[model samples]
Target: MRTKQIANRFREVILDGLWIANTNYKDQLSNITWEQATTRVESLNTIALLTFHINYYIEGVLNVLKGGALEIRDKYSFDAPKITSEEDWKILLNSLLDNAEEFASLIDTMPDEQLDNYFVDEKYGTYQRNIEAMIEHSYYHLGQITLIKKMLSNE
Candidate 1:
């Protein structure tokens, strides 16, 4: 029930089927070239960097969901790899989408009761909180990606 809802929310933001926002990461990033994604718009973070940042948390939480340790760090979230070529950009985009699907699938299988349990530690709050934060956080960056794309197109 709750897990399904959380998973749906995550899918809505990262994959397809728009609900809260009219777009998703796959929809936004699929057509962007490596040059466009890596282009700087003023002092804002590039679309590639933003994409990596969003996936960083998803992959981290996914590790814990899969019974691994929480190994993600804030300082390293934006440390995106250099997307020097079309292949590099494609790899990062594919990884983001793939990890997002896996993360959502894992959430979909979680028992409702597990959502109330601590994620990796009490400091991080419950699974529900963390998952919700992921959705919200993804949306926040998704908006940025959309704007950055628009800015690039206008240039």
Candidate 2:
């Protein structure tokens, strides 16, 4: 019973970080193409890159949970597709949402106390830090997404 409560709390954190409030950047940036999505008016990274980066962490965490190491190589580089076609862009957007749900599910079902038991990655920090970092990381990128949209809409 206690485990379930902790699991529920972790699930809430994941949901709140990834979607609950969500900063509404995705909603405002709706109907954007993958091309424009990655286009930065200045030195700033584009929405596609931000979105990709966000998912990149989610993917990386899921991988770590599945026994992969905390890879800090160039693998997390912003390398998402520049969708010229509207259908492709839509697919990516939906995929992100679905993946976030999947991530939350993973956290929700996990043994509650295992949240800090460390997966033991030698190269990177413990699983504890990684999971906690995702919340701040996602929020940081949300700011970027919001600013990028504001910039694009202004010009």
Candidate 3:
């Protein structure tokens, strides 16, 4: 597949699960209240923290795609802002969606040669690998969010 085609496919599955069986972030995370978002289940990260952590890579890579240096630190990925109200949660979710859209657009414009080249440094792997990894990462956390929601609902 071409570069744009690959990027488009990634975006569809990552953002909305367009052609995938699992629920996307939009569907899974929508309608979440502050209570649900901030509730902790055992030792697992709260849904709010998981949500931000999932988007952290997207925001970092999006910056790199826009010619900025990456500034992500794994230790801080889960440090989402405190959800004091519904508006706070809404703002965070909106930012996540906005960044995802920008990242998708940037990927679509990337040269095919870039996809084959190493992303940032050779130790990190190729652009294609890193991009796909982000998709996998999001889905992984989205699953956690889904299960957490279900667990909370059952309580």
Candidate 4:
């Protein structure tokens, strides 16, 4: 039950369905062009950068969920690959969406009891803490992406 709720929240942020913000990553990013995604707004990070940043943690946590190591680092989270063309942008977006789905799916199948277990190490807190943090973090960047899109459109 708890796991399902957490997974659903994850899905609601990245994939289909909307409960908190009324918009998901797929919906918000579907019509965004490569040019717009890569466009800069003052010192703000580009939409593409935010997208990559969000997925960085998702993929890292995802690996841990799949019985792998916690290999992501904060310093390298924004080291997004260059988006040189529409194909490049599409590839990045697709990867994010794909990983997001997989991440949520893994969480959905997670045993509720596992949520209490420490993730990677004690310093990182429990699986539930990290998962919830991902959801919140995604939402934070999602808002930035939406605002960046609007700023780009207005320019």
Candidate 5:
């Protein structure tokens, strides 16, 4: 697997919009008010919850890439702190965007040999697989956010 190719895909999915869709997390979550973000839509996760949930893995893997231990716990994935105002929501979005850029940069610098190596353990599959998973995970939640935003707008 070519690391740059994989990294490019990661950037496209995380920050830049991919060819498969015209919007990415950056575009989808922009200028969202706290009311729209925290508003519940049926049984689906709130936009805030889903946004934080998607970044949970990215932040975890990013920590590992930065030489920290993996600190992710599935139980706390959706436990984003209370967002009482727009400032709180923007803070979360900014953190997500910052991490996305840093994570993509880390992936771009990964040596080809490292890409094939297992991430943390064999159970988690290769680094390539893990990075791709982050991309897929982001896209999946991006769709959810888009839908939730549309619903909040009564569209």
Candidate 6:
């Protein structure tokens, strides 16, 4: 009984993260290109990069939580899509949405104990911390996506 309750709560957080990913930002982040998105006022991070960053870590945490191996990539930490056509941007946004759902499926099956397990030297945090932190991480980029959209609209 208690396990189901805890699982439901964690499921809610994961669903919230997915909701943050799939919204439209006044046409700013949803369906735009890096070339179309770049601006002197905007850092190269752009909406596309932000989408990729959020999804990358999301996939990382989800895969790791489900006992899959992790991969390394050079994203928002060092550099990002400085030049991309509109088509590329749409592809990325779609991928993020698709993976967001995949992560949701992963969460749907999480055992309560798995949520508390410690995987040494594996992910950004212990399993519980990873799940908790994903909420903040996804929302942080969602906020960036929202702000960039606003900046683009204003320009």
Best by lDDT: 1
Better lDDT candidate (1, 5): 1
Number of backbone collisions per candidate: 0, 0, 0, 0, 0, 0
Say which prediction, candidate 2 or candidate 6, comes out ahead on TM-score.
Answer: 2
Please list the residue runs of candidate 3 whose C-alpha ends up more than 4 Å from where it truly belongs after superposition: none
Tens digit of per-residue lDDT, candidate 3, span 53-75: 87888889888889888799888
Would you list the rank order by TM-score, best first?
1, 4, 5, 3, 2, 6
Write down the lDDT that model 3 would get: 0.82
Using lDDT as the yardstick, the better of models 4 and 6 is 4
Can you give the TM-score per candidate against the true fold? 0.98, 0.74, 0.92, 0.98, 0.95, 0.70
Which TM-score value belongs to model 5? 0.95
- For residues 1-155, what per-residue lDDT tens digits would candidate 5 score against the true structure? 48888888877876886586787888788868888899998898999988888778889999999989888999989889998999999988888889989998888888889988989889999998998888888778888888889898894
Residue 116 lDDT (model 5): 85
- Global lDDT of each candidate: 0.94, 0.64, 0.82, 0.92, 0.86, 0.58
lDDT (C-alpha) at residue 6 in model 5: 82
Estimate the TM-score for candidate 3.
0.92
Encode model 1's per-residue lDDT on 1-155: one tens digit a residue: 99999899999999995877799999999999999999999999999999999999999999999999999999999998899999999999999999999999999999999999998899999999999999999999999999999999999
Clashing pairs in 2: none
In model 4, residue pairs whose N, Cα or C atoms come closer than 3 Å (at least 3 residues apart or on different chains), thus clashing, are: none
Candidate 4: which stretches are off by over 4 Å?
A: none
The digit string of per-residue lDDT tens for model 4 on 1-155 reads 99999999999999986788889899999999999998999999999999999989999999998989888999999999899999999999999999999998999999999999998899989999999999999999989988888898899
Q: What is the lDDT of residue 71 in candidate 5?
A: 89
The C-alpha stretches of model 5 lying farther than 4 A from their native spots are none
